[model samples]
Target: MTLYEVTGREMYLKQAADLANLCATWVVSFPYLLPPETPLARLGANLTGAVWASTQNKHGAPGFCTQSGDALFKLFRTTGRAEYAELLRDVIHAHAEGIQPNGKITERLTYCDADSRGSRGDGGKTGWNETNGALMALEIPGIYIRTDRSGMFVFDHVEASIVRQDRRKMVLKITNPTRFDATVTILAEDARKAARPLGENAHLHWKEKVMVKAGQSIFHTIQK
Candidate 1:
């Protein structure tokens, strides 16, 4: 997508979309029912969006090893495909499940027979997992809404609602329940805006950032 934006080449966009679909194959589409005694099961963790490492490793993890996977979001915006958005949403939410109160996480969110299966692993504070999670939060919008279709999609751990709406504006109430502070991204678009071609760094223009302290709520109003 960036390549397309930079070079105005149709080939680049097609290649990026194809690559995003290929990456989707590695993501677990269904939640596995783990052994009742497993730590993940006891904690009610869902592995729906966990990405498998490889055929040999046979283990699934919260997000990408070292990248945010924001390319999927860019593809969604460019193609107007809900599947791309939904795939990233699942991964983002799954990443939250393994996070500790202090924002630490282990890469092992597995369902395979590996030694670390259904466990967070003893690898304590896997920096890659933390990096991916933070990158997703920073790059992806917490909530996206399309005014023309009355569509809303959430991709963060925070709670959100459309508290007020009229012809001129829409108001949102977002709450953060985690131990750490959150910077929620809100992206809203009308039909004309949504139909426009996305350029490099287009998200920065459409997204609004709201800072919510832990266990607090804030109201954001967006003009139509």
Candidate 2:
């Protein structure tokens, strides 16, 4: 998508979209029922969006290993495809399921019996998990709405709503229930803005950041 934006080339956009769709297939589309008394099952994890590591590994995991899948969101915006957005949402939400309160996660969120199947091995946090979780929170918008009122999408583990709105502006109320402080990205654009090709690192210019302390609420007002 960035290539397409930079060079005004249709090929790059098509290639990006195709690659994104392929990546979507690696994400689990349905929940798996784990054996009773397992750590994951005891926590009531759904595992609907766990990502498969690779054919060689034969195991599923919380999110992408090294990076957050924010490209999926950019693809959705550029292509206007709802499925891409939904895919990213599922992955991020599922990633949260494996996280412990101290910001640690085991890489073993799988049903394969290769290494004690249902157990989250050794109870250690991988560097990739920590990096990806932070990347997802910082890069993807917690709540996004088209300024023309065409659509709305939420991707974070937070609560948000348009508390008030008028012809000139809209007020959004966002609440974070987690114990950790959250910096949420908010992107609101009209049809014209959405239709334009995004430049490299364009998100920095188009997004608004709101810092909500843990277990607190914040209101952001956007001009239409």
Strongest candidate by TM-score: 2
User: Which stretch of 10 consecutive residues in model 1 shows the poorest summed lDDT?
Assistant: 198-207
Q: Mark the regions of model 1 whose C-alpha exceeds 4 Å error after superposition.
A: 175-181, 191-207, 211-219
Estimate the Cα RMSD of every predicted model relative to the unseen true structure.
2.8, 2.5
For 36-68, candidate 1 gives per-residue lDDT tens digits of 898889888888899888758768888998877
Deviation in angstroms for 101 in model 1? Answer: 4.5
* The 10-residue segment with the lowest total lDDT in model 2: 198-207
TM-score list, all predictions: 0.83, 0.85
Relative to the true structure, candidate 2 reaches a TM of 0.85
Look at candidate 1 and tell me the lDDT of residue 81. 89
